[model samples]
Target: MKLASLKTVSNAHNDSIWAVTWAPATEARGALLVTGSLDESVKLWRGDELEQDGVHTGHSLGVIAVAAHPSGNIAASTSLDSFVRIFDVNSNATLAVLETAPSEAWLMQFDLKGSTLAVAGGGSASVKLWNTSAWRLDASLSVLKSDASVKGSEKTAGKFVLAVAWSVDGKLLACSTMDGTVGVFDVSRGKLLHLLEGHNMPVRSLVFSPVDPRVLFTASDDKHVRMYDAKNNSLICAMSGHGSWVLSVDASPEGSALATGSSDRTVRLWDLSMRASVQTVTDHTDQVWGVAFRPPGGEGVRAGRLATISDDKSINLYDYS
Candidate 1:
């Protein structure tokens, strides 16, 4: 797989662009790219031309994460102040505003069926799950510390959940902490399955293989991306090359490739089958905070597309194949 720079939107936002996701296509419109920034706004861009569609600006602080519903009609954005705003993708109508007390939000994601929205609870040491139907607090999967003492101080102990992901089957939920521990949970039972360990620094991003529910990938401040077997809690492999922290990692829908953004100011595409980076694009002047692959399936769409947002206040679109 290779990435050909299709377009670059310089100064896409006033401040750092931290979050990005693809709103799936509908009969009325094609797939749109949604991005959130430290400028306290979420903006939409349509087509390969990267035309600006609209912007929503009510967030009090920097927007840390953005997620799109599977149906492409709804999307959500979270801010540093612990607020989650869900809105209509096309109309930008506010659907719901979710607030999590005792926890701040970091990353947001929708499950495969789009029935639930998962938020990375920054200081709560948990994953806050919200029901999409009534926009209610569904459940909180708290990560238990290894220490048996001081259990009451779980909220203050500083796990600082930084990233979250769900298996394609929707049966498994994985979350990573600032200390690099990854917790896997059983969604139906609401139970913690196991903890995977390797890195000593913060784990900023992770994604489950779209084709294989058991395989999981993670990027960390340790400057390495590790793959694991979620069910068995076994480390499968580790790939390293970035000169700085690896901030984000995403798997292609075909499951044959992975894309990662880093503090090294570059985006690297990995060949999963070979466990190595095959292509590197060094176009961003600042750290690349987010990298996302457009989910396959939209009218007249065939070629794969990948996007990267950066601290340089810019967004880059690439044609992937």
Candidate 2:
């Protein structure tokens, strides 16, 4: 219903923290808070006290996105330089390093089954999928195709892919581009199903509802969050409040609520049933870049938790119930 501030860590990173996600708990430990930053480091924290568990540094540029495999043993991170590193969560051992050149990698996500890693290709106008078993390049799902004669730089600038999301069932994959087009694809057949259009500005973040696979939510530079029925290709509704770009969005595990981070330097809690923002938390001094909900299942981990990272070089934890 609402988020109550539990703890705040200042200077959590040397520079701006750009991304955050919770690694599911294993028999050895509870879920760990994973954060990537402009400092070119990825750090892991444990418990509500936010103790530092580990720090990984290899990225040549600022880390842009981080994702945890469903099994919780493996994690991956992408940097601005377009390189992806997949590593072991507990041992911090490097598992694989993927070089995405020609096409840039902006955001990445592991499917529900952890069989594939999907990276939003910034300039390729496609989503690149890697097979987890072999850690090999699997396929590239093109969201937009232009004339072959179009110059590479011009084509990339026009339709850069910024974000990607997997449906609850892992049957569908949705990717958003710089031109405000959201493409829904059928993973099995590797075909684009439809494009959801409404916002004219870049759509930076998106997610599929946990309860309904067909329902999708997107945050855009247009300063509004729009809900759509991806399967039907229909816009359901749009909610507005953030004064600047909506940077990130995540749905509650129960699918009844949503959480978002914005350039307005605030984290907002949205009541999905009401389709409006119910609470705003202005705890960061600069832009709020990432917000994530702790995944369910752990040793006696029942209470809900939300973690947010900001350009202020801080991390905030909230008690969600």
Worst 10 residues of 1 by lDDT: 149-158
Question: How many steric overlaps does candidate 2 have?
Answer: 0
lDDT of 1 at 99: 80
How many Å off is the CA of 45 in candidate 1? 0.5
- The top-ranked prediction according to lDDT is 2
User: For candidate 2, what is the lDDT?
Assistant: 0.93
Clash pairs detected, candidate 1: none
Q: What is the lDDT of residue 115 in candidate 2?
A: 98
**Deviation of model 1 at 194, angstroms:** 0.5
What digit string (tens of lDDT, one per residue) describes model 1 on residues 106-186? 897999899999899888888989999999988999887556666666544548898899999999999999989999999
Report clashes for each candidate as comma-separated counts.
Answer: 0, 0
CA shift of 222, model 2, Å: 0.6
